[model samples]
Target: MYEMDGEEIFVIDGHVHLWDARQENIIHEGGEQFLQCFYDYHTGFTPEEEQWDIDTYRHYGADRMTEDLFGNATADMAIFQPTYLDDFYDEGFNTTEQNAELAEEYPERFVLNGSFDPRDGEEGLRYLEHLKEEYDIPGVKLYTAEWRDDSKGWRLDSDDAFEFLEKCADLGIENINAHKGPTIRPLNRDAFDVKDIDDAASSFPELNFIVNHVGLPRLDDFCWIAAQEPNVYGGLAVASAMTTNRPRKFGEIMGELLYWLGEDRVLFGSDYALWNPDWLVDQVMNAELTDEQRDEYGVELDVETMKKVMGENAAELYDIDIEAKKRQFRDDDITERFDLGTHYGGDAGAAAD
Candidate 1:
């Protein structure tokens, strides 16, 4: 948890992944290209001194990930948003099982979300059920633009996709995290279209639709749609990175979101590995809207607003007991491992070695 202005803000990074993008994992050209694209974004936004080498970026294991997220105690909790690109990778990119490695190790500090491919048809539905049964996933991260065989992508409003949404509802899975985009590699406008979300959100009022990256490059459309669909939310994965060198722009985006979706609907994400939560969390915590932007949007990025965006909103979505988790963390395994028990009233703080 981050102590900002003397108030304890329980930080829950809404988006993170334990991925394997090593050369061996890259079975297709797109896999290499996709990881490269992620690297590009990482380097573009990350500070020079903090940047990881290409090799480490390709495959930073579970231990490093654990330290990056919790060793500092800045983030109280995190959610694993898996991006399973089966077609592009040999073993699939960041499958549920892959993320589960870390999530299982630190169950108290992580929420493991699963993935689904509508193209899998009956088999896909079965797999979705399996994920729910095995992992008890409270939500799912979907790449609508993920490649499957020769098909480039699918749409959220499609008949096939609705079937999966129906199953999610039947299974009591409420959070539907869709990767609406700013054009990541192999993800295009047609595949990552923001308009499809309108019909889907309208159709599944029972499910919460969290649009990752706030549909960048189509922020206007996203904001317009989110204004109408109460269940719709914005996840600050790619957008949060902009706060570093593009604070003004980030503030404008936040202002628009607050004006349209209000403070409750926007969530912060480091898109970890792309940007480490340790630093990104602080960057966002200090970000403020410029005077011109404040006048234009009539919204403020105040502590209360950030409290919701950074943790409370996701807590509500995932049904996490923040107080209970905090109490438990007083002596949880992570606390002992990282010597954070004192920070939580157990001992003294020590960085993860």
Candidate 2:
């Protein structure tokens, strides 16, 4: 929990992953390169002391994740977003089945979000139903660029994809978090384009479309689409990390997001394992938009807005009662057992190590 000026903030990391990227999972050289690519993003933005070695980075299991997110990072709850890179890894990377285990062990602390591949067609739709039944998932994370057999990627606007979206609507899975940001190697860059979101958002008015990373490198396009579509939301995963490395750019991005999408439609996420929530949360809590920036973007980053972005927005989306969850956190033995004192400063980075 982050407290400021006598107000306590309930934190929910809207995006997180638990994956198997170990050497054994690597199918070929591209798999190793994919790991290296992620490592580059991790090391480039991460503080020197917080950076993880390759061995630890490849497979940081559930215990470390629990410590990082809930114990040391000030998050009251986290939503697991699965990224199943079946083509790159032998056993597939971070499937819903793996994430569901964590949700099961600590039911109160986590929300399990399943995934779907539109390319799978009718069979895929059946799998989605099975996932919802087996895991009791409330939402799903869609990786439009994930490789499957001969197909390299997919789009939200595709016919089969629309069918899946319709199924989600019918099944009561309303939140659709789409990965429209950075492209892992072997996937075409166009696959990360934000254009498809426009069509999908229009087609699926009942369902919410949260574009992950806010479609970085294409923020303008995302903002344009989000501005026109009431149901389209911006997920602040990669953009939030920019607060550490590129504060000005981060301000600009936040300014634009608030200006276009408003406070209610934006959600916070650390893109965990790639980035830790401790610093991200602390940085966002402490960050302020300059007067010139406010004038330029015609937006403000006030306390209330910050409060909404950190957790309240997500709580509302997931239908989680913040006050109730806070009470549960206070009574949780696991939360009580771990010391959160180190989270005060840069020392939080060492907790992950």
Output the number of the lDDT-best candidate. Answer: 1
What digit string (tens of lDDT, one per residue) describes model 1 on residues 8-43? 898999999889999998888988988988999999
Candidate 2: stretches off by over 4 Å: 186-189, 339-353
lDDT of 1: 0.90
Candidate 2, 1-353: lDDT as tens digits: 77778776778899998888998898867678878888888998888888889889899998888888877647878999998887778887788988876788888889898989988888999999998999888889998877667777888999989999999999999899999888765344577689999999998899889999999878999999999999999999988887787888889899999999999999999998889996678887777788889899888887899889988888888899987765555546455557543333223323365
Task: Score residue 135 of candidate 2 by CA lDDT.
Answer: 83
Q: What lDDT does model 2 reach?
A: 0.84
RMSD of 1: 2.9
- Looking at candidate 2, the ten consecutive residues that score lowest on lDDT are 341-350
Among all windows of 10 consecutive residues in model 1, the one with the lowest summed lDDT is 344-353
